[model samples]
Target: MSYQRRLHPNLHMETDSQIKQPSGRWGQRTAYTKAPNITDILAELKLGHRVTPVFAHRSYTWELQKMLRARPRPVFDLCYLDGGHSWDVSALGVFLADRLIRPGGLLVLDDLDWSIATSPAFQEGPETLGQFSSDEQQAKPVRLLWEEVLPDLGYSHFAIHPNLGWAIARKRDTKAVVPAD
Candidate 1:
């Protein structure tokens, strides 16, 4: 949210996430901040009118699926994906977001270097061990998507910032036509 604020101050952003404090490591941290969700931060900053917050009742992936089903056409110029870093959640979410983003729009994937094995929150969990293989746990899912998925989807001007742990790609401008020789 702060990054979006800094990048595009006037942009009216639609943010989606589970309303409750998250279930893992961040949930414990939220107890200290008292800002359980984005809603609280919006209230504190008084940016409610500028930013639309959609709280997911089920999960972020479910909410994104709902958005794709309900919306008739692409609505956002920039789709910033920061939720659901795992392949199970993110792959589907990014695919849906591709449809949600308008032509010539930007798709920003955050935490490109993130992986279950490296994440302190999930590294020691039995659930993580069962769900992800050793390679899957170590694999950078977002970076994998950036390289393997987005290129196949035909997005242009791909930029990867390893140090910053994020990547950006632009949906092709469908309206543009090439000149014949």
Candidate 2:
């Protein structure tokens, strides 16, 4: 459900040597120096749980598209988009997640507040992109985006984490038919 750093052997070995432990399930380390790992999603799928992990960057997109295109339709029950932070990218991510999620499925957006909190660079007229921009000129747009624009979209559900940012969305209607394989 979330990305985590890979601990070095020295750190991991200290935990327990006696027991045969279950391996961790999340993706590869955040650096992306190595190949992408979706072991968590794979494990979930193996257990008959649906999963969809978005890879917004070019490198990840190439890999993700290949994997998704080969899978049966409506393969995901939920999606969490914590990838890129650009406005365009965020919007696209929401759109894509909307398409992939099953009706009544949840879609979580990490760092939505982060963009609003730090938005001096990308300006939108009189307002800043976030609530706390470095420049006064930028703060208005930031507040407007988070407080007004996002709400106007009628997402129907939202949770704001003081440290983590926002989780915004609405569940699609479950009455819609899922395509038969």
Give the local distance difference test score of model 2. 0.45
- Ten-residue stretch with the least lDDT total in model 2: 11-20
Runs in model 2 deviating more than 4 A are: 1-68, 116-155, 176-181
lDDT string for model 1 (85-125, tens) is 78978898888888788888999988888888877667445
**Clashes by residue pair, model 1:** none
- Against the hidden true structure, what lDDT does model 1 obtain? 0.70
Give lDDT: candidate 1, residue 34.
38
**Candidate 1 residue-wise lDDT at 79:** 77
What are the per-residue Cα lDDT tens digits for candidate 2 across 38-157? 544345347324443444334333433554576565445556555445554455555555556666666666555444334333433224333333554223332334455444543446
CA lDDT of each prediction against the hidden true structure:
0.70, 0.45
RMSD of each: 5.6, 12.8
Model 2 alpha-carbon miss at residue 117, Å: 8.0
